[model samples]
Target chain A: MTESAAAPSGPGSTAASPEVRRNPVSTHPIASLLIGLLLLASIFFALYVPLYGRLTPKVGAWPFFYFYLLAFMPVMAVVLWVVTLLQRRFDTEAGGPR
Target chain B: MSHVNSTVFTIVVAVFILVTGIGFAASRWRRTQDMMHLNEWGLAGRGFGTFITWFLLGGDLYTAYTFIAVPALVYGSGSIGFYAVAYTIVAYPIAFIFLPRLWSVSHVHNYVTPADFIRGRYGSRGLALSAAVTGILATMPYIALQLVGIQAVLTVMGVGADTTNTYLKDVPLFVAFVVLAIYTYLSGLRAPAAIAFVKDTIIYVFVIVAVFYIPAKIGGWSHIFGAAQTHFTSTNPATGKPFGTFLPTTKKVGSTQLDFVTLALGSALALFMYPHVITGTLAARRRGAIKRNMSLLPAYSVVLALIALFGYMAVADPATVASVKKTGNAQLSVPYLFQNHFPSWFTGVAFSGIIIGALVPAAIMSIGAANLFTRNIFKEFFKPDATPRLETRVSQWASLVVKLGALYFAVELPKTFSINLQLLGGVWILQTFPMLVGGLYTRWFHRFALIPGWLAGMAYGTLAAYNTSSPTASHWASSSDIVFGFSLYIGISAFILNLAISVVLTLVLRAFKVPEGPDETLPRHFTVEATDTPAKERASVTAGEARPAPGV
Candidate 1:
């Protein structure tokens, strides 16, 4: 971390050499796409009220709407957890964390 | 005077003092050579780890408003109130996508406020000023809502409910706010970040116990849901209509399904834009800390989902209902339920939790607003040569002024008004989305075009909110109104209008070959890690924090 100060800094590198490290998105397109999908899915299940906003189906005494929201929390946590790991891997792979 | 629970009152006061002591002591927590820099005072030296970030953000986003107002809404209107739950659920993923980018950029550039980022990205002072002003304007009512939350707790404890004289009635609330303002001015962001630990612990203990114990006391989870279902389904004698839906439905005229979805989506987007939440995110030590915290912060939402059901629990316990009926304020439902069911000693623990919950967010918000004023408004426009010492001092005083303004809003406005004002705040802050969030990914938005887009959205949202009338109040009665046949949150509606105008005008401006402002940030700057930036450069970046790039 302390060695960053010694690294060639700023937009100057882009003009100086063709070997400049690209932005993370271009460097890891597949991982970036997967992260986007994971995020969008998390948001989708959450906001699509019709998917879980009902009462008939019950989980132990919770109405389905209530149960779904509670259950969705863990699912979201796991999904974002996966994305975080992927981001860590790519950040390291893309020239070792900037 | 109304009957005061001595046990509850004592514990509440004791907890208040404990946290107040903690707030002042926090300035020394991560000892630094100098406290005058905005980096130290306003951003807590930007060294918070993942655990502290989780608690700080949790304490920040799930506020006293979430505790008191959300349940009150649920108690009054049944399932529509759960939009808060849905809103919180979605806020993480949305923030997960944009916030890390913001964190990286701000760390690289030493941008202290969202408005600072706008100024750097667009190189437009007027647009940045608009962002700063909107942030401070939107945040006031939100701080006011926190005070109102504290007031609800006090009123239920019967501390001032007996007094007919208004001044006398407000003395406890006045004392509380003054204490909060003093510590916040003394310690800045550290005050709230420190107090958040104690506050969340107390809240977790009480909420979990209340969720389980209260259901057991009031007859089991099935009975509570059953009772709520039955009550919501029953007709109101005065209106000759059902109280509210037990579940959000697509069948109604002003369909709640659309309202639920829009409210959840709009609030999720707006939550991160609030300067305070941004302040919380920017305080972390590393960009990765924010993403890790995003997954972890939803733990608070599970607690929030349980808290919202306090409304249903209140419904199931008829004595609690009858008591709230006499007060004529549904915000008292949760407080009253705890007071009625829990032993007085335990009730004291819960009441203090709610009070401290209000204080933590209130402190962070004022600090957030103050940072915006110091960085974007004061330093940007008035004092370009302001020293870091001067900036921190100015921010301290600005925080006090912001808190005082919020106190006035809480004391003078109808108690119900703050909720809508907060939603109206969401309406106003979401207008900045195109400029702040949009500028992150693309510079295609013409700087000049964003101004009118923001103006149109703010004007339309304010007027729509002002003219909205409910059965009880003449104006500012609701946050949602009919927007093209669907009952949607006004913030979402205005955001669409804002985005459309920006896109249309950007095209025209591009066609005309108008000059785009200088962009200070490089492409890699948006993805730069803390470890990537040199410590010396990071320390010096604040010197030119608001200055535009030298050239394109």
Candidate 2:
């Protein structure tokens, strides 16, 4: 565990100790931006009613409204996983302990 | 009472006994050296890893109510019930944004509850007290809702007494509550975390089997949906309106598309703010564990979506619908549907799953409430020099008191009252969002300003909820209220009012040069993760020395 701390620290850590590795979200703007956009897209997809609330299209005996919401669960899992991965890029870039 | 299936009842009893044993034994499951601290009792030592945290949170968020009531709503209404699914889906991304920060800051400062963080950030015990009180209030109904879930299962099982006296009628529920209280007292948060594994597995197995097997046994998915559509479209003789909506309607005056959107959004915002959810989050091992679980926890939401389909299944099966209508309780739709469709032994499994489902979350909720009382109320106000052992002891006894308060809610009140109170609990808890979540990212909002903002949100939410009524009840009938001819979730509307008040008051307070309370946190503190050894040191140190500044 101590050996894993040998990473270039980001700005989050003020101690400047050799053992302390910073969390990357504090210094990585791109990661924060990507995560911010993903959050917005997620909220939009969830809250936008007219987009998928219609009943014409049915998938596998389920109404489009129900299917759209159900499908968004897995899609949300994937998008959040992508965000986690994007955040991970900062961890690797800063060589911080994950 | 209807005929009790001996086989099903016997199996459920057996499973209940098995879980009770596990709950008692969990005290030593992940044994820490010092067991008398609040960290061990209230948060399972705050050392839960990714896998354990996953199961624990999955079991925490998706409770017996989600299993029973979401489907019950779908059976009663229609597409509006699917708002639960949307709320859960959106809840993840929202949690993804704030939970890591919360975990990090709490970990660094050894904050035990959200109110502890509030007190530290805003330097106001008054604000912290408000948050603490709201958490406990919101949590009691939620815990009672879990009991209602158990009652629905027991009622369907023919075990509930058909008597005039409430105590005689609720003997089974009381017995279950006693066992839960004992085990939770013995094991604390570990009791729930350990038992969550069994509860979730049974739920998954039964829900998956019921999803595939029951539809085929009744008719098909197409047949079920078609029946639901037809039934909901037909006019009811009593009210002269359709039974429910096949899809969310734009033309409707009350239950329109906007209500659906607001309900979903409001519920999503309220989900993570609940004290039990925060307890689960704060118990995780690392910052990354929280993030990983957030991305992964929506798998349970998929299960929830499938569970919601059972409402349509109940609609498709005429016998189940008839039985539920005969009882005048839509909450029994899922249990009756399961009993009618599955074999006696499988019915036992499903019933036990729901009952155990209630137990896990109830234990967690009581613990959350107890922690608030111990940390924010008891220690903060009355006992300044309380020791770690005393805190844990007080929290243990406090968990019992909290459970009994929830029991009063479940027994004394009507089921509709309890359910609506749970919704009202959502509205009340969401008022804390600006102060708790806002404090995480910024401290610009004056601490004094937040107090009035909280007051405004609480007053508006309570009055609006009190004024709104359905045909059945007078006060706290529904969570949404009409605003500008559009029905909106009261939580969202109140939250908007809360933020607007806070912003205006903050500017005024700033101009008048009101002294902002000392912010003990640095920016870097929000991103720090706990090292294994330092976690123990911090836990012991904070347990001994932590106290809010005097006379804030």
Candidate 3:
């Protein structure tokens, strides 16, 4: 079953070349890199508690930690939107039909 | 059981009947000639637009467990429970990176389940079976948690007889479960997608109203926070430590900052790994729909942030606190708060919202687990020649069995056990990340290596979780444990071990010139759009491909 299924794709060795060309993120390298870094930074901001986990700076009733986490949601939405836009550029550059 | 509020009970029953009607009628929605295939039954025909996709994905991801459990956590602990908020926030960006690729690949290949994708990618039925088992295992506790949410609401409504017999006591829950099971069997994913509209509307209306009205009714947000801070800071006599910190503390003893960070990261990573979430993602019509929904879904998280504040509201209300304390179940915190603060009709609305919320996700989750069973297990092992009609029948029955198993867990086990098991579910599901997500970008990790890595992670996670105990319970007391004198989420720790082991073993396996499995997918397949009808594609594949090909 597996062998016949593998037959159409020829062999595993020949499969590598097309995979390299079609790598999604490699099409727009700089934009993908920036998007990757933005994703990391967003995660870092949310998780690095030492940076914002404090009570002194309170937004209304929210502590700094709570406010920071809640605020990051919108920021993340925007970051992800930008990433989507960048990926769209990559998609166009690669001449992939949407 | 003791005193049923006639108005609230009547309203809840009315709304529930309406929801059940919608659930059954959803089969006619987006009417298709063939509802026998996995795509129609499991993925709602894979043509959901942005609007329905948003509601379905939102409804699927944020279960009644989130509604009941997040606040319950905040009511019991303090700021650390806001890890849910942080997790949902970060989950989007992470999902944005991979979910579209997954959707595109699954669409192009007509893959019904993640395990199907894993099998095709790795050419290892054993690896795919492992993924299927983990998905089903993780989802059982999750479905159980939804029932726990419903049970909490029913207990608060005083619906069942206060008998010594457990069966009589849970008659209402049984009735609710039967309705959900029947509708799901009839309508499959469409039931949840159709009903998600009503569910999200009721939730958004009630939550928005409660956030505004409840705060004003209980002095203000400032007062709620003050009450919470005071309550959490006070010492518990049993533990001789502070109840919890109002803010996450840097100290080592309780609710440590590291625990908060790790829990958030671990949950974010685990959220998309759940088969149910992927089921929702794959139901969408296009990759762009998924990407758009990823950005838009955070709107639900904003609502979740406000919902978490209900814990603070409960803390502020002395009546709510006294009622929850009387029941000795912190899960009832939000319900008690609602019943105390809102009018009878509004209480009914909120309760119906929560009950229906549980129903929607529970249905979707069962479908997800059932798809895994039918596609990766039953079809893979038992009946390779199964027809699409047979496959759908098997999945429908598998969903019912999965739900019943979850019902048994919810009814028999202690409530805390189900909640802790849900945490353990997150841990168990994270073990699959390397195989599922790693296989997406690169097939470098050998499938053989991934199996052992997953086993090591699962074994280490279970043992670590078992070893950790608290004053209230022993064995699987919490999802966080002390690692090298710092508290960390057990999932992240286990994941680190899983990844490291897989990487090391992959190097070793390569050195030995092991036969890497045949790769059936091309890189272009991951970005493929739905140019032709899915049925046409499936037919073409069936005509061209070998009979034993894993994905349809």
* All candidates: TM-score: 0.95, 0.95, 0.94
Error of 1 at B448 (Å): 0.6
Model 1 clash pairs are none
lDDT of 2 by residue, A3-87 (tens): 2233212223334452445545567777788788888998898889999988768897888888898888888989988998898
Q: Interface RMSD of every candidate?
A: 4.2, 5.8, 4.6
Q: Model-by-model lDDT, in order?
A: 0.87, 0.87, 0.86
Q: What tens digits encode model 2's per-residue C-alpha lDDT throughout B250-313?
A: 8746667899989998898888888899999999988999998988999999999999989989
TM-score of chain B of each: 0.97, 0.97, 0.97
Model 3 lDDT per residue over B1-552, tens place = 448998899999999999999999999999789999888988888889989999999999888878999999999998988989988988888888788889877776678889988988888999999999999999999999999999999888887746768989888898899889999999999999999999999999999999899989889978988889898999999889888888888788569888988999899999999999999998888889999898999999988998888988998999999999898988899999999989999999999999989999999999999999998999899998888889999999999999999999999998888988899999999999999999888889998899999999999999999998888777888899988889999999999999999999999998896877766666666766555454534532422333232332
- What DockQ was computed for model 3? 0.41
Pick the winner on DockQ between candidates 1 and 2. 1
Clash total of candidate 1: 0
